[model samples]
Target chain A: MALTSEKLAEPVAAPALAEDTPSVAIRNLDLAFGSVKVLQNLNLDIRQGEFLVLLGSSGCGKSTLLNCIAGLLDVTGGQIFINERNVTWAEPSERGIGMVFQSYALYPQMSVRGNLSFGLKNQRLPKAEIEERVNRAAGILQIENLLDRKPAALSGGQRQRVAIGRALVRDVDVFLFDEPLSNLDAKLRSELRVEIKRLHQKLSNTMVYVTHDQIEALTLADRIAIMRGGVIQQLDAPQTIYNKPANLYVAGFIGSPSMSFLDAETVESGGTTALQVGARTVPLDGYEGEGPLAPGRKVVFGVRPEHIVVTDAADPAAHVTATVDLDEPMGSDSLLWLDMDGHKLSVRIASDANYAPGSTVGLSFDLSKSSIFDTQSELRL
Target chain B: MTDATATYTGPHGPKPKRRLSPTNIMLYGTLFVVAVYYLLPLYVMIVTSLKGMPEIRLGNVFAPPVEVTFEPWVKAWAEACTGINCDGLSRGFWNSVQILVPSVILSIAVASVNGYALANWKFKGSEVFFTILIFGAFIPYQVMIYPIVILLREAGEGISAVTGTNFRLMGSIWGLVIVHTIFGMPILTLLFRNYFTSVPEELFKAARVDGAGFWGIYFRIMLPMSLPIFVVAIILQVTGIWNDFLFGVIYTKPDTYPMTVQLNNIVNSVQGVKEYNVNMAATLLTGLVPLVIYFVSGKLFVRGIAAGAVKG
Candidate 1:
């Protein structure tokens, strides 16, 4: 099977704690819509100047969490703190947070300059300073030429940049973005994604971004909070999330051509436990060595597709041998689909190799980076 | 910079260009027929207004006048009488303007307020108040005139102590203005409410986050979006209040009666032989303000409001 390389990283189990105050902290937050509980006991703390991204599938309460932080919603239970202030009961304006909506919520009647200066006007800023900030933000976004145009006159990308520019002019402590690049096309989405990261780097304020796109979350976030069913399954740096996912759900998420899983058992050899799949055994390596793993437990083998190597010549008694079913060669990286037993697995191949679709290739499973997980809880062992 | 202008094809492709066919022609023909059916009465009113009483009595209502004369126009404008005042339809013109102006202003103002409250703010009686207001709108104007007349009499007598008999609101121009404003309410609120609801919740959120208070959002965001719908609201209120007959007759004094009230009196004057030509002219002339408004701003009038405030 073809394998793609993944960057190694230290554990990012918790966010970086600053000596100063946290920008936003929500404690034991619970929210419900009608009768449905959307967020259950969500505890989150974001440090100042950290670009935190809520990475999850749709309906996973990422946007809900952003709204909660922005004071746009009332929690069913719990309090929210912004810049060390208890802002749970406060109105959105009092929160001192600026938000960029997915729909680019620029006022249609207002010009680009008006949009950037709108918040400042509301705060009763001086006319000169308002113009200065608007000009500066427009310059940063490269929308100075279009300042006189209404939102309807601007393109989708221009509108989003203006939305961001509006938030930038606020010059507040926190910047919250709810999938700001979603309205733009793929090319625009990537370009705006870079712009947001650069903006975050420049502004150095606490930023919380929400997106279902893993690529955006992975590239833009300082630390990614992977959510599922209103609960944060794992919150870690992107490298940690990609290399060592906290659980099966996280392993399944966070990576393109996702990590392949094989139902396995823990087999001991010389006081070391190796994960046993069908007719194959692989080392548990760093995880098994670090944590005390019980023998004979049903463990799931988790290995990234990027780590799987599809070779013509194979060494005897390799980790796992699976027949390659399909191969897709992307420009920078290729994807290889392998069928092991009944489960069809995806393997990320880093090169555009001239490989046929149904070639029966041997697999040398990379043991140093494999994950062993408990079958019942799906937690990494 | 290279990727800035790159475009991706959207989900659905562009639609095929349209071409008119025979079925389209048939549909348009049917629409034309329906339009003529609606406009036939207006045609008769004009045709009969220009004809002499002899020609009108000949019963060719659809036929054009043989000798088109504007003598009836002069008579309707200058010589019709209402209880010894022979100042014609012009007698009620000033009173009608007074009633129409104030009623339109007051009703438009109240509707904007009610629409703002009902759409965004949800106080205790908000929904119930809206329900009652809408119900009042749908209720026939005839059903409302009784309570209104009684209320006006009580109110006028209360104020008569100060202004004496002449300035009494019961049978004066002010009474009719109040009646027209009250009648204008239901539809105005409903129109603004529906229009406001269509606006994105995100726009409201942006405004709120921008530190705009309750009234601020309504005025700055909601009111500024008064486009197409403003035209709609004005036209609806203008037509309804302008063509108002029952309220004008019931509430107004004999001296302060509007053109519709005078038009009715002229047709039913029963002073020897009824002057049909002058009656027809007066009827058409009384309808002139709205008709001219429609002709001039007809596109906007058909748009349903007086102002195009909610431009997209």
Candidate 2:
């Protein structure tokens, strides 16, 4: 509850758009290696100055899709438009995009200043202009003091800063980041995550980031595209993806300690719809979904740990009676594992509250926040 | 508890090693024998080379010279004869320089480009080309000697017909240079290819995204980062071409013979008072170039080889 309040404290203002043209667009993008399809029929439109994140577990084609957008990988069939220009067949440099890699691929032999200026020099930019751009980038990255040092002479975070400075000096319209902070330790990862979020706010360039960490996707992305098996499972704003997951996978993936599922059958009596769980019937009032709940239909009731309340006394009108199986006390809160009939459920409570094993407790469910899905299709209904 | 604490005196740490334990004896004994086995011949050579002919004829090859003289080294440098040229290895030394310089430069330059292309900018059929090139490394050099001679002769004749001049590669120093360059290519290319392949792919991709073309990446990124490997290639080619005797004797005439071939001539000539000191001095002189190169860049050679070994 404290974490939710802290998250709600900060307002995420949507960037206002002056024009309708998307900065980068991909249509029917298809990529494969020999015969193994990595990404199939993928489509995306990144609005100007938008922060879009491609999120998934490993080998889910998120990085592959970022490479495709950067023109690093040759697509099997598709067209990519950058700022209204067809760049599917173009070189990565010609796509007017700057990219940062996870390995901090700054030139090892070159000084940080040389790394920033090498690209400009290759483009035949004037020496003064190159110097100016390199200095400006170094200043913005706060790496001006480390300019003369080689990459090996710097720490991991400093080297990553130089890598970002290398991209920042290009002044491209779009920025592509391929898990740029995945190499850092946890503390540095969180620090750099905030730095990257602040960077996006300052630059406001159309940025596409790739990461497998759900916390990163939730914190840094304006809109997150969750991918699985080379397909986009759902694409929406972070809060919407959290509160209103489109499918079972999205609901399970975006939460920590994950949402628990309970098998139930829909029942109707006297024009009142309810769910029968084991031997107890819970009212299905205020439930939001696509269609009406019919009697005798098999469905799954998914609920998050934070949405359930445990009462000391077993009220007859309570949702279900559960026995306290185990109690785990985390620093800020405690998680109670309870057994209802033959099913297991986890509920979050304040850390100070402790329950002994074998104690009977009544649980109340928040009907408005819970989800009901078709048992066979696993889709929200 | 006080009695227990007072009596407690267990061993605190690891047992100290003796200076001459059985394992140490066996290890150092084997090492000493190997060192003597390799170094004894060089020691004998050095002692014999510094002694006079009279001292050498006394039959004690290991004895230090009563009176040391630089005469043998001087004679080997300026007076010893190879065929009709009495100029000794001096002439052949210059000839070897011509062949060695161009051969080392050309072979390393071309092989490094071949490696960079194969490792990074892979074209269609590059693996097949690499396979064939590496395949050349396994073939015996003696088997290719005759065919290479024929190829050189035909190339010379074709050039003579076109240029309207007496142009021949059959018995010239340039002919030997080309042979050494071609022979050095396969192994040197493999060394460079493996080294370049071990460089992270992300750096190459980063260079490409930075607008670096093929040659730009080669000169700015690949070339600078690969200095250790280049030192490795240079050392391999220099020593291989400089100490070559078979190619020198077969490809070039006596006037253009390399130092090794001329040293052979001076030592194995049919009619001459055998000069043991001169021969030893000349043999040492022939090996000096590669010895100096190995000592100067030995550390980088190990690092380069280790780098190549990692990914392959």
Q: Which candidate gets the maximum lDDT versus the true structure? A: 2
Give Cα distance to truth, residue B311, candidate 1, Å. 18
Tell me how large the interface RMSD of candidate 2 is: 0.7
DockQ of each: 0.60, 0.73
True contacts kept of each: 0.65, 0.72
Docking class of 2: medium
Q: What is the TM-score of chain B alone in each candidate?
A: 0.81, 0.95
Q: Whole-model lDDT, candidate 2?
A: 0.88
* DockQ of model 1 vs. true complex: 0.60
Prediction-by-prediction clash tally: 20, 0
Q: Relative to the true structure, how large is the alpha-carbon lDDT of every model?
A: 0.81, 0.88
**Candidate 2 lDDT over residue span A153-189, tens digit each:** 9999999999998899999999999999999999999
TM-score of each model, in listed order: 0.87, 0.94
Worst 10 residues of 1 chain A by lDDT: A1-10
Q: For each model, chain A TM-score? A: 0.91, 0.92
**Which regions of candidate 1 deviate over 4 angstroms?**
A1-18, A288-290, A312-314, A350-359, B1-41, B54-67, B122-133, B140-143, B153-172, B301-312
- Candidate 2, superposed: residue stretches over 4 Å from native: A1-19, B1-8
| Candidate 1 local lDDT, residue A92 | 92
